[model samples]
Target: MTSGKIGNQASLQSIFDPIIAAPSDRPFVVAQLGQSLDGRIATASGDSRGINGAAALDHLHRLRSNVDAIVVGIGTIIADDPQLTVRRVDGPQPIRVIIDPKGRLPATARCLATGDSKCLVVTSKAEAVPKGAEGLVIKASAPRIEPGDIVEALFKRGLKKILVEGGGTTISHFINAGMIDRIHILVAPLILGSGIPGLSLIPVGSIDEAIWPKTSAHVLDGGDVLFDCDLRHQRRG
Candidate 1:
């Protein structure tokens, strides 16, 4: 649930109700990103602390609560070392998913180490799965696992709905592959003149060729804006 007067509890929850109700037999993918006015997700040093305020973070937690699993890429693991758990809010811990097709994440990494929650490491490292994680080794190249294959695997694992919380490259992968069902982009107040961008995998010849999702936006607590974009058309196209 991103965008528009999220202050109302009922209204905020309503935003994600449709997404949460997506057909359960298949994988419903929702991608979330918090970026700057200039479109950078993080600075050159990879610091993304508090880009969006507490309210936005709470929203993220709620989204996580609604999903059956959370997916991310190795870049996110390396840069943020995110726990990928619900801490600020009260909810069940959704399964944590990491897309490290090469098995790049170290065994000591937070997402793989503590085992506070179940984690699925989607990799091409077919030989071994780390101690605290399960492996879904796609027969694809390292760092380029097919999103469709990953979705199918997750569905087989009983995870019908997936929330992809990502670093730029990972988001771009799903976007370029046209596997995303919806998008929730949080735009913060600051700007980074040069750094990592939000989505970058698609190439367009003109503004008319740009991929546009049906969207809406609303303000958050700390001068940030949430953009709730429906992208089912992409999935069909």
Candidate 2:
């Protein structure tokens, strides 16, 4: 039973799909989500109760199986407190990553717990590094490690691909910093009316845009939409 918990038809294909289906040379995938037309990621109390569906959830774990790591910002860690493990399918376990600017993860956090996969905590502040997390820490000297620096560090560690899944701020930081190689935006059927926009900041533009990544969007089952795009040089018109 995949995370989607669907019938055997969809389940069968998902179960047998190759774990390493992604191209070896491709950079990591950064997936971001906003909400449906209503503009909400959760209900009034801030719970992601209906943020994802069965099929989408299953596909999410399947996608997780293809990457080398999964990332999120500290805000997500505090909010959802996810385990960040791939459980629905069988595959090589990917590393869990957290971008904690201030090293805010609690020692009691599930991410620091054993049973789940180990986590890589990236931060620039010295005090943020946890006591038992020396090996897991990737310290950057910059006041704030830019996206390029983060990717370069990951690459040096032999990680050719990674996946970033989180709230709007983290997504925007990567996009604006121009480190995201590819983006997958899953749009649910409902909306939040007033919550965080999918992106914290949208790049201002025309031919003079600082960054441009070629992007394409697609509609999926159950009113969900997916946008997969490559981020690279864009020649001005």
Shift in Å, residue 30, candidate 2: 3.0
* lDDT of model 2, residue 4: 36
Model 2 gets an lDDT of 0.64
Scanning candidate 1 in windows of ten residues, the lowest lDDT window is 1-10
Computed on alpha carbons, the lDDT of every model, listed in order, comes to 0.82, 0.64
TM-score of 2: 0.76
Q: Whose lDDT is greatest here?
A: 1
Tell me the spans in candidate 1 whose CA falls farther than 4 Å from its real position.
Answer: 1-3, 114-116, 141-143, 234-237
In candidate 2 the C-alpha lDDT for residue 190 amounts to 76
List model 1 lDDT by residue over 1-237, tens digit each: 324576755678777886767987678999999999999888878878878888789889888888889999988998888889888777778899998776677777787765367888988876556778888878885448888888888889898888999987887888888888888899999878877788887687777777767778988777788888888753221
- Give candidate 1's error at residue 98 in angstroms: 0.8
- In terms of lDDT, model 1 sits at 0.82
Runs in model 2 lying further than 4 Å from the true structure: 1-26, 38-40, 43-45, 114-116, 125-127, 131-143, 205-221, 233-237
lDDT of residue 24 for candidate 2: 63
Q: Pull out the clashing pairs in model 2.
A: 36-190, 38-191, 38-192, 38-193, 39-191, 39-192, 40-191, 40-192
